[model samples]
Target: MAKRRLIKALAALLAVLAVIGIARAGGLYLNHTASYPRGLWQKSGDYDPTHAGEHPYVLACAPGKSVRREFIERGYLPWGFDCDGVEALLKRIWAVAGDRWTVTDAGIEVNGQLVPNTQPLTEDSAGRSMPVQTGGIVPVGHVLLLSDYHPRSFDGRYFGTTPIKDLISEVTPLWTESP
Candidate 1:
């Protein structure tokens, strides 16, 4: 009977620990939810853990209307805004201000060098055709967000460039993992 009681106690302890962990993961504090430092789960291959060490993260504040529309269509509210959408995004700087950027339906080139695996698609998942914006001088106060790792990443290839006004902060990953 003592052994059974000890086992039951251990199971109960484990259950409590599990609940705490789940609450923490879900941003819940006891019965309430914590609000600071909102967490975002990344499901796409645009950015990878391997590149985090090599690149300094740039948290851009500017999210254009097209990107906002795309996020809404995809059912992602990211920053908790109902219509305006996420005000900032953590993206690696693929092309910076004053760099010669050329974009075409075939691929993208930065400073005359073809960015690997950055081919623009003719159509998206919804069968809507994608537009091609020819390469041009990356204007002052604008940045391009693209990843060589993700062949099909939705980035500058589809949305063009991000203005500096939309940038909010440059952030380092506090905790990240791949599923």
Candidate 2:
């Protein structure tokens, strides 16, 4: 009877361990390779990252969007490919630039030269042209994020610059081959 009880207890412990391992692996997989929209880019005007129920300011790629393929190939999932992705990339750039960059009313300036407004010069839905202002200095640990598709994207110009801390993580591909 004692032997049987010991065996059962050991089996239960093993089972728990297996479950935990699977959960952690699954979470890592989702973070790096999942292509589905996790509510990063919400069209709702009231979106707020600080609020529990509100969506974050980060941008994520649309489902089945071809742009995601490039990111996946580069070992990055479209984590915050929308607004957040831009922020992360900008942060990386800032990290590389170190003390040579500055944000201003005209836009980002590198060594006093305005960082060309890469975002397309266009108008919003209300017939008002989107503001070209990149705003403020690129302080240490801060980045000026923008969209890959500037003409059609609502990025830093729409939601403002994001701090490095706000960036969750760099997107990573789940598998080497197509799923």
Q: Which portions of model 2 miss their true places by more than 4 Å?
A: 1-117, 120-122, 134-136, 173-179
Q: Estimate the TM-score of every prediction.
A: 0.57, 0.35
Query: All models: lDDT?
Result: 0.58, 0.40
Mind giving the per-residue lDDT tens digits that candidate 1 earns over 81-139? 22255534445666776788888555788887787778888877777776546767778
Instruction: Give me candidate 1's TM-score against the actual structure.
Output: 0.57
Please list the residue runs of candidate 1 whose C-alpha ends up more than 4 Å from where it truly belongs after superposition.
Answer: 1-55, 74-83, 104-106
Model 1: worst 10 consecutive residues (lDDT sum):
28-37
Leading candidate by TM-score: 1
Q: Give the Cα error of residue 149 in candidate 1, in Å.
A: 2.7
